[model samples]
Target chain A: MRGDLPAPSAAQIDIVEVGPRDGLQNESRVWPTEDKISLIGEAIAYGAKRIEVASFVNPRRVPQMADAEAVVAGCANAPGVTRIGLALNLRGAERALATGIEQVGAVAVASDAFGIRNQGQDRAESVGIAAGIVEMARRSGRSAQVTIAVAFGCPFEGAVDRALVIDIARALAAAQPVEIALADTIGIAGPGEVAALVAEVRTAVAPLPVRVHFHDTRNTANANIWAAVQAGASVADASLGGLGGCPFAAQAPGTAAGNIATEDMIYMLHRSGIGTGIDESRLYRAGRWLDRKLKGSSRSKVLVALPPGS
Target chain B: MRGDLPAPSAAQIDIVEVGPRDGLQNESRVWPTEDKISLIGEAIAYGAKRIEVASFVNPRRVPQMADAEAVVAGCANAPGVTRIGLALNLRGAERALATGIEQVGAVAVASDAFGIRNQGQDRAESVGIAAGIVEMARRSGRSAQVTIAVAFGCPFEGAVDRALVIDIARALAAAQPVEIALADTIGIAGPGEVAALVAEVRTAVAPLPVRVHFHDTRNTANANIWAAVQAGASVADASLGGLGGCPFAAQAPGTAAGNIATEDMIYMLHRSGIGTGIDESRLYRAGRWLDRKLKGSSRSKVLVALPPGS
Candidate 1:
């Protein structure tokens, strides 16, 4: 039971696979575009309906995602999949829309410190950028989603103000995006913080579906996800094999920053009786394939735990 | 809030350190007794009031714990530390008491299948053995704690009945041990299961303190701990570096069975505004030391996230 709030909006949650976009973007390895397409196809085969397949950022800024157009063009027409592309500006959004992707994900950081460092803009400027992208997507007849990065905490600015985040959500919601996702970019959040923030954001953006992107840096991502679900989040983001992290957040020493492993989250959600409509065995197979391609950098324990026969 | 139960009993929790005993027992490396003692000493230095330092099982069964006597002799007298030793039978209990350890941890399997496989006894026989150990500890004027293994689920028997676990708790509580710990031996439990079962068991054994021992085999241990805490569990068990599982449980392919990492749990609890009274930096230091000694098998993310200077 979610604390003093309505139960989760949906019994069946849509787990958006973010490995192709978020997971591979932070890796040191620049995977071949075919390999990236194969990974996205594998996720689709394993029952990923909503997938963030690529980021249309500058090729020099993020060389790993340089093939965003190619990747989207390759995987945009997968059967029964809603292909998503990340966009930080109108140009990126137009590029993504040109590829026939279904959804464009625009992002704005909560703090000016992070916004300037990450996107060369202040908080207000980044929000304006995201709003323009959302408007463009809507005018072009494509759906859009906005994510608030470091909604819980930030490395550049340390503790982010909740009131500031709520205000940002309110502004982002004003543009009427299809969904608003709150990202714990540094993986420092616990359940209480997630619950309180999601409740406030849900109220601020009435009727707009809220999602969460959690990092397992401190091993609290699963708990944070449960709390977010309890707080009425309908969609959750994860990376296959626990791959991915923000490049800016990787400067810290010994950081185990990664998205929650898709298979691991599926294990917990399935066991808890929450429906994700994702196939666990197929997901595991995808993870095994990813692990081999990534040369065992995957931090997912479930991939190693469920050996072939049992 | 715990579903249909009283609020948690305490604002602060006493986390029981179990790295030296449970963590080492599953490892192939037979650590030197001095290293074991130093680890225990480090836990004490880090404000662990209660620690499971050693086990007095047969050397032939668990060669890793063969230095139990030496480990106890070295760390049992640490000031203000309640040193605990695991005892599977009356003989082990007597050996633990002889070393002047403050408490003996006696365990009983909730399922007959697990009982026979793990201890070569049926459920009733294992309970009988545990009861004898508890009674002996009581007579010797030393405190005893009873752990119900596989209280949530069993690998061999599959899903364990909550009624059966409630019955086992009733039986163990009847022996009047100081604390009754319910262990998620196979790590299949989710927060909902944990909250529901803990609520039932807390009712079954009123006034007998309930502690939870969680395994992160499925990446749900942190959430399970939060559920257990909400259900009025005041004491939680964890290993220092996420380093231990049942030797018997390790035979299965992909059995990523290890106790919740103490540092990770502390990070969650502390960040949630719950007090553990343990020094975080010291805990990280000990983890780093253990990671170097154990050849870096420690599964703790916090150790890697928080570098020496950070």
Candidate 2:
């Protein structure tokens, strides 16, 4: 019913599910590899065609996603669904490539402080990492997406110089990643900033697709996403049930937490008649499952609330 | 520091804190009239130059605001504060005018469906009420603000036609309420929708100030507020911590059940080095008092949390 809104023609956006990696990575709980795989399968059923299953980071650091390979192996039979893995370094990239997944996502933080805090590298270093990962993914004939986190405003540095973000985006443009996503990692962006940056990046990247990732920390993530949408950025990242924000980040650079919910975004787009191939009912179920797994109630307004008057 | 955002000198903006009236009116738990007044005083303490202390609605319908007169009396002495009473109709307006509050706000839903469900009136009928209230206020040399609730989207009718909202806004423009606030009564707007509407309203009402009230029902309130801000609508209506929404509207119209926190908005704008003339610490206190009076925790992200990256 929501999808039939505005009109049937507006639903053309694609949402990439980031909960299995972004969601799980932030929680203190360690889901069993089996449970993690089940989460992935549920997301696929709930209309997640492309899902970031796990990050190939050091197990010592992110003990929860240590079984990245197993999760992908389990998801090998997910029909037409695309399972992407996150890679932080060369080893992570190599491990991701070996999983036979056709796509991999590499992250680069925009602020030097956050880059050191989050990526253990500064801007230039992360750019080099992106280049390496892009080369490997290209060699493997797989799709690569490089995301620039904190591209709008940084919790550490604050209002990152636009020139700096564009410079990295321009460099990543050369690597020719299948996509580049600008992330408001701390939820510091507004729609104007989103539009301005996305417009700049769209021009900088020319024909390349751009995606925007936003955290609902300031309650503006979805609007920023919409701003990005109008600016010609076709891809967006959302977590189910609004799950996932780094616990450390949640304690520090946060007043609230997590990425926008998948179903909520779908509902808005659907209501506006924006085309996203996600199934709302399935996304609702995925939200329910994530809520149970996290032992918490979901925060997605539409997924849980029955109807307006109800 | 989010409110500390640096920017070119801002055009003068007027803010109306609707917490006591809009925020408390819809809350289910009946806060005592005295506690309500204390909340208003605290809201004023938090740098709200304009505060809506209470709604002069019928006590039978809204028992929470029964002592509207007393609430206004309590916050009257806060120096430099402009107090506003919520007047729903002619009777309500008379009661508010009798209380000696120099300014009052009147509301009507633009969507016929919403008007019937909430106001028990048709769109045209409600607009007439608003026009009458504006005339009365003007004759009395009192400033009035007429708000169009559900201006973005309606629950029963789905996406409200922009043209319809625009037309009603056009009609209201003729009466010239000191300000016209567009309410996302249910938090149904996205950034693109927000930008388009703000631009439309600005063009329609040349020099009159436009205020935007958002219910972070769909995690887009802050971003939409930002969009509205850049669209030349400078004033934003935010509860202490996004504490309330239309009980009729409910939640994740995105996630994280709440309104956009006043402190959060001020912080967002402030940290960007924008000037809000608000103190974050005072906002936290107001939020805490509201939470205590309600016998629950404040749902505001920034108010409950200390400071981002603290």
Candidate 3:
């Protein structure tokens, strides 16, 4: 029985570096635009093919993203990298398009309560807006994608309906976005839920790739990501030093566990014989640099376990 | 494709609470024998069926386990709960058997380097000693189990060979222990590796169950545990508050990441529709109590994310 088991094939996994946008948005202190540019550059040098560099939201609402355009302009000279700008509305989409970023990411909420609280729209309305953003990006010859936030569970509504997520994915697929993503906004998903949902959504939107974003709030992010990949999700979103949280989401006091750390993710992937084109050493270095810039230790265990210069 | 995917059936998973033995052994400060008894009683209250209450090792080497007999005596009257004692060598095994504990856990090392360093025995010597301990337990009419430490990776030798692990498992199976466990002694393993190894080992040791033990050194413990279960591992070892580290293993400076927290493990297992016979609310309460006693916060993300009272 042991001899009959076949070895798992090594497959390339695409990692979307979201350290600059999703990572910094929740920090208490605002990072300088120059540091944001440097982080983006480090991500590119570490072989991140696609990076979410900035979010074109209202400056007053998200002060950390106020220098979005400056950060975009700073990375305009990078070669062989697709720069993605996240947009929550038409105005944000237009702003991202005007900046000539390579890709535009649209947001759709899976729960009505979170949808209304997060962006003043219901579930259907959020999906419609996200589809419209995809259409706008398509017309402008830019790649576009949609991420269904809180698709697994919602803080206000508890468990979101799985059928609702399928409907949202099918609706977003009509606009022909590059891919559809499921975001565990509050990080309350387990591996089984992730695998089942990713498989269902992958079938719901055939020919379109599936991406996954997870928070490490409950320490299930890495397991959820691994399950998604096993269930046919091709793209995964991660942050440097595991630095990310949703400022709009209701969180426990002093308990803001961020997104899965890129270094830790890469270490697991590479050790498991999966091919991720990112450099683990560079990720550790970038995490250390971010730690110095942020004036705090990184939450990444791999970064903390390995030596500073190793 | 998604429609054809079957819903995974819920299964009962056995959780072996090792808080008293593995959790406190690596702590610099020695906990009182009374506190150790309290911890054991709390584990029983939380529905832990089998608990490793103490290690019959040298007091000079591991001062935390100095009062192993006293601790065992404290929990001797607990009904329906199997109190396990970990023994490293013949002397330790004799001591554990004399204490009248319910189970004796013998540890064998997968790598020669770790075996020599951890127990002053090489690979063959460790296996012989563990097998001898199993015989001793059988003659003494007590249940025994064997754990192959560093089965995944070693701090000194690095990646351990899968074939060597299978051979060790098969050799240990000849001793007729209750079960065999694969321990990531240095906390270095990925989900993919865990799934493949567990499947192969389960086959190699047919009729005997496979248990898994992981440390959260690189933050992959939860993922690894999930994968092991998917691959047919029936039992898992976890510590309260994620408190464990090998005092003999080569570790990075100030980087002694412990085992997966029992609360986090229970949350993931229960959320994934698997039953562990453990109460989640009681786990959080016990974790809070442990935190107060240890004078530190728990490493469990769920414990940290949820409120203390909840």
Candidate of highest lDDT: 3
Backbone clash tally (model 2): 35
Please write out the lDDT profile of model 3 over residues B47-97, one tens digit for every residue. 899999999998998899999999988876577889899999999999999
Q: DockQ for all models, in order?
A: 0.41, 0.29, 0.50
- In angstroms and one decimal each, the interface RMSD of every candidate reads 6.9, 5.6, 5.4
Q: What is the DockQ of candidate 3?
A: 0.50
Mark the regions of model 2 whose C-alpha exceeds 4 Å error after superposition.
Answer: A1-12, A77-80, A111-113, A116-119, A153-159, A246-249, A253-257, A308-310, B1-13, B77-79, B111-117, B156-162, B245-258, B270-275, B288-296, B308-310
Q: How should the candidates be ordered by TM-score, best one leading?
A: 3, 1, 2
Better of 1 and 3 by DockQ: 3
Over A179-271, each residue of candidate 3 has an lDDT whose tens digit, in order, gives 999999888888888989999999999999999998888888889988898888989999998877532232543223478899888988877
lDDT of 1 by residue, B1-310 (tens): 1121122335688899999888888777788999899898889988899999999989998899998988988875777788889998778888889988989999999888888877677898888899889988889898898999988777777777778778888888888898788998877777767777787789899999899999888788898898788678889999998888632344482242678999999998877766788998888888888888877767787776774565
lDDT of 2 by residue, A24-137 (tens): 887667889888888888888988888989899999977988998988888765777778899988989999999878788998878788888776988889988987898889
On TM-score, the leading prediction is 3
What Cα-based lDDT does every candidate model obtain? 0.83, 0.74, 0.86
The local lDDT score (0 to 100) that residue B226 gets in candidate 1 is 83
Candidate 2, after superposition: displacement of residue B43 in Å?
Answer: 2.7
Error of 3 at A230 (Å): 0.8
lDDT of candidate 1 at residue B135, scale 0 to 100 = 89
In candidate 3, which residue ranges exceed 4 Å CA deviation? A1-10, A246-257, B1-10, B246-256
